[model samples]
Target: MSEHSIEDVTRVVDGVLRSRRSLRAYRPDAVPRAVLEDILDVASSAPSNSNTQPWRVHALAGAPKQALGAALLAAFRENTLPPSPHFPHPLPEEYAQRQRDFGAVYYRTLGIDVADMPARLRQTEKNFGFFGAPVGLIFTIDRRLAPHSWLDLGLLVQNVMIAASARGLGTCPQVSFARFHPVIAQHLAFTEHELTVCGMSLGYPEHDEPVNRMAMPRRGVREFACFDQFE
Candidate 1:
C-alpha cells in the first residue's frame, strides 16, 4: 500500500524528468557509494524484452576513473581512437540538422564563437575527463545481441539518468566514449562477447555555470507524433 496520492506521485515524477539535463560541468564533491548503488538498483528494474536483462555497467571513481580518462585523452590527442562502429555511418538530414542546432546553442551558451575551432576541440576533449565529474560510468552489452537488445539497453540508460535525477544527482550520457572503446577495454576487463556501448558522467552540477543551462529544444508532439482514431 502506498501513501502518496496520484497527483503527488505524478508531480514528483514529472519534476524529476523535467529537471534532468546533460550537464557539462560538475562539482568535485564525491557522491556517497551507497547513493550510487541505490541509483543503479532502481535503474536495474527497467523493462527488457523477454526478460533478457542485457545491460552491463562499470562504474569508475577515484584513481581508476582518472587513469582511464588519461589513457583515452592520450589516444584522442594522438588521433589513435577508432570511429564509433556501432552507430549509423550517415545520419539522416533531419537528425543531422538537429545535432547541428544543438551544437550551435551549446557552444554559444559557453560564450564560444563558431569560428573558434581550438576552443571547440578543447570542449569536445573535456568529454574524456567526464566534465570534471567525480564518477564515470561505462555501459556495455553482449556483442552478439541484436539491435533490439541495444534498444532495450537504451531503456536501462534512461532509467539510470532519471533515477539519478530523482536523487539530486546530475548525469551526462556521452556517446563520444564509444570512439575510445579499445582504450576502455584495456582498463576494464570485458568478456570477449561484450561490446562497449557508451559512457556517462555523474555528479552534482555546478549550477552557477552558464554552460550548465544549455538546453536543446524538443520537437512538439504535432511535429513528431501522429494521431489515430481517438478523442
Candidate 2:
C-alpha cells in the first residue's frame, strides 16, 4: 500500500522524533491556518483507548491568543489562584531527581544560575506568553473520564507535537496553564464539563535562542526498559 520501503519509513520517523525538542522561544511570524489544520489532521491518527478520542484542542493565535496570555500573566503575577497539582505529593526520589536534572540543564543552557530566583521567575512568566510562539494550544478532557482517557489524550498531544515537528515547526507542552483553569475556562468559554489538560505553544522556531539548543539527556533503553521473552 506504500511506495517507500520499511527502512525508509523507519529512518524518517526516527529522524523526526530525535530532532524534536521542546522549544522555549519562537519567531513572531504567524503560522498559516491551513498548515495548522493539516498538522492536526495528521495527529488525528494517534491511537485512542477504544477510539474514545477524549481530546479537545483549542488552537489560539493572533488577538485571541494574546488576550488569553495577558489574562494568564495577570493571574500569575497576582498569585491568587489555587495551585493545580501536577505531580504527586512527596514524589518518589528517582522521578524527582529527573525533574531536577531537567531544570539544571534547561537553565544552564540559558546561562541563568539556578540560584537566581528572580531570573527564574521571569522565565517562568514566559510560559504564560506561550514563550513568544504565535500559536498557543489548550487541550482539555472531560472531567468524568478515567485516567485511561487522559492517557489517550496524551497520545493525541504527542502526535500533534511530532506532526508539527515533521513540518519544521516547534512546540512546547506546558502544564503551567493547568493552574489557571478558571481563567482559561472563562476566557475560552468552553464547557464546564471539561477539565483543563495542558497548553502548548506552536510556531516557527527562533533558531538563535540558546534555550532552543538545550537537550536533556534520556536514560538508555537498558536503563528504562524491561524485556524477558526476547533472545
Candidate 3:
C-alpha cells in the first residue's frame, strides 16, 4: 500500500477543477469506449443519499447519437413540444442580470448580434448535435423520486464532468436538452419512470473554435457563501 502527501493531491485536484469549463465545440476525434467507461466508473463514486445511487446515464455515439440529435432538431424546428421552462417565470433581478451577462458575452464571442433572433436560434439548434462533440450523454432518474433525491443525480453529473476533465476531455452540461426531453425519451425508448435530468457533451475540445476560447466570469466564494465562525 502507498500513502500520498495531501499537498500533492490538493494541487492536482485543484488544477483539474480550475481548468474545467463548458466546451461549446469539439474536434471530430473519437473518444475510445474504454475511456468513457473509465470516466463513468470514477464518477460513480459520487456520494449517494443513504447509498440510493439513483442515477442512470445513457451514453450515445455513432448511429444512435445521430438519431437522437436528428429527432431533437426536428422537434426544435417544428415548435411543437410543450414548453419546458429552464428558468423561473419571474427570475430575480440579481440572477436575471447574471443570465443576461452570460448571453451577452456568449454571443459576443461568437460575433453574433444579440438582436439577431434568427442567428441566435440557429446557434441554439447546435445543442442537438452535442456541439460537435463525439459523445452525447443523457442522465435520468426515476420520475417518482423527490426533489431531494434529485440532488444525488446532480452530484453524479458534476462528478462525470470532473472525471472527464481530469482526463483532458471537455464537457458541457446542458439544461437546453430538457426542453426536448420528450424527443430524447422517445428516441432512447426510456421507460415512463425515467425522467431526464440533463444532457452532457463530451470529447476533445476544438481549441480553434471561438466558442471554446470564451471565458465566463464567476463570483468569488465570499459572494456566494458565508462563514458562521472564524478560525
Candidate 4:
C-alpha cells in the first residue's frame, strides 16, 4: 500500500506518451484476447457527456478480420468511396495545412515523389489491409449524437492508445478506413444508425522497419497555446 506523488504520476504519463507511435508495420504474433479486453476496459473509463459513453467499437481478428481487409481492398481498387454519414465541412486552413504537412512528410519518408501516383496509391492501399496487423478495430458512434460526442469518442481513443502503450502494445488510428465504412459496416453487420468514425490497427510494432522510425515533429506548447491574464 504505497501512495504515488503527483510528480511520479506525471513521469509515468510522459513515459506512456513518449512510447506511443503510429505503428504501421507489426509483428505477426497475435495479441491475446484478454490483453485487448483489458486495454479497452481502460479506454471505457474515459469521461463522456452525461456518462452516455456513446462510443461503439467492433474489434476483429483471425479469419473474419482478414476477410474484411480483403473486401475493403477490393472496394478501394474499384475507386468507390464509402458513404459518409456526416462530417465537418470546410476544415480551417491551419488544420488543413497540418494534415497536408503530415502527408508530405509521410510520402517523402517512404521515398514516394509527388509524381509517383502509383506508389502513393499502393502505400494508401496498405491501410485497408491494416498494414499486416493481426487485429483491426472500428470505432463508431450513433448517428444521432452531436459533434461534441465525437470529441468524447476521441478522448476514449486517446485513453485506449495510452493504455496500450503502458502494456507495450502499439496502435495506429486510421481515418483512412472511414473511406470504406460501408464495406466495414456491411461486413460487421452494423446498422445504418451507426456511423464509423475511424479505425485502428493494434499489435506489436516491427522495430526493424525504417518507415516506423520516422518521428513526426510537434510544435512547442507556446506555439499552440495562449496564456490569458495569468501570464
User: Over the stretch 1-231, how does candidate 2's per-residue lDDT look in tens digits?
Assistant: 299999999999999999999999999999999999999999989898889888899999999998999999999999999888898877799999999898899889988899999999999999999999999999999999998898999999999999999999999999999999999999999896888999999999987888998877889998978787679
Ranking by TM-score: 2, 1, 3, 4
- lDDT against true structure, model 4: 0.88
Please report how far candidate 4 places residue 179 from its true position, in Å.
2.1
Candidate 3 lDDT, 27-91, residue by residue in tens: 99999999999999999999988999999999999888998998899899999887677677798
RMSD of each: 1.3, 1.2, 1.4, 2.1
Q: How would you encode candidate 1's per-residue C-alpha lDDT over 1-231 as one tens digit per residue?
A: 189999999999999888789988999999999999999999999999999999999999999999999998899889966678755668888888887898889889988997899999899999999999999999999989999999889999999999998888899999988888888887898878878899999999998899888766889998888787558
lDDT on C-alpha atoms for all candidate structures: 0.90, 0.93, 0.91, 0.88
Runs with alpha carbons beyond 4 Å of true place in candidate 2 = 229-231
Model 3 is weakest, by summed lDDT over 10 consecutive residues, at 1-10
lDDT at residue 68 of model 4 (Cα atoms)? 92
By TM-score, the best candidate is: 2
TM-score of 3: 0.95
Cα RMSD, model 3: 1.4
TM-score of each prediction = 0.96, 0.97, 0.95, 0.92
Provide backbone clash counts, one per model. Answer: 0, 0, 0, 0
lDDT of 4 by residue, 1-231 (tens): 149888898899998897688989999999999999999998999999899899999999999999999898999899768445443566678878887788888888888996789999999899887898888999999989899999999999999899888988888998877878778889999977898899999998887787788788899898978887564
Best by lDDT: 2
Error of 3 at 195 (Å): 0.7
Stretches of candidate 3 exceeding 4 Å from the true structure: 1-3, 228-231
Sorted by lDDT, highest first, which candidate order results?
A: 2, 3, 1, 4
